[model samples]
Target: MTGAGGNPAPSLPGRFGPSFDVRTVVVEPGGSRVYDEAEWRGAIVLLERGRIELVCSDGGRRAFGRGDVLWLEGLPVRALHNPGREPAVLLAISRRPARR
Candidate 1:
């Protein structure tokens, strides 16, 4: 969805822009969430609070701070971790799957 007087959401393939869904995720201090490969496919994420790190399958890691946008599609990350003392929050936007 677009913000007040902001540019409209970009067009999508199988559906319109407004058909996408947003999920708010909270990562507690020192906590982690396993990233199932398929779960984040085509997902767009925005980091809103604190800091987070993406732990890759190859034992590498990348950190992101607030206001950073992420495209996790096709990434080999194994988990998302909150490396700061406070909680980290993020918004994940993904297109809603087609219904039967």
Candidate 2:
């Protein structure tokens, strides 16, 4: 994601384990970013505040606002755009298979 000054946002910091991980991200207004779908295979995204537009690989676009919960397992998310004037806060929860 890009910050207010057009600089890339700082890397998300979070704890990871064998089965799960969680991260919080904040996108500045007009900021746009992309993520590797394979890296987030079984994740769920929770929109905490503000608004964002999610664009899929097939060019489909969907807008989400505060309190919206999205499942990302099947959709190929190509990009995320913050369209609101305020920052957009989101929580990403990813589940992983148990390690052998």
The candidate maximizing TM-score is 1
Candidate 1 lDDT by residue in tens digits, 5-94: 353332322242567786667778899989876766777887867899999999999999998999887888899999999878777788
RMSD of each: 7.6, 5.3
Question: Candidate 2 — which residues are off by over 4 angstroms?
Answer: 1-20, 96-100
Per-residue lDDT of model 2, residues 34-60, tens digit only: 856664566677787789898878898
Q: How many Å off is the CA of 100 in candidate 2?
A: 7.9
lDDT of each: 0.77, 0.73
Which whole-number lDDT from 0 to 100 does residue 57 have in model 1? 91
On a 0 to 1 TM-score scale, where does candidate 1 land against the true structure?
Answer: 0.73
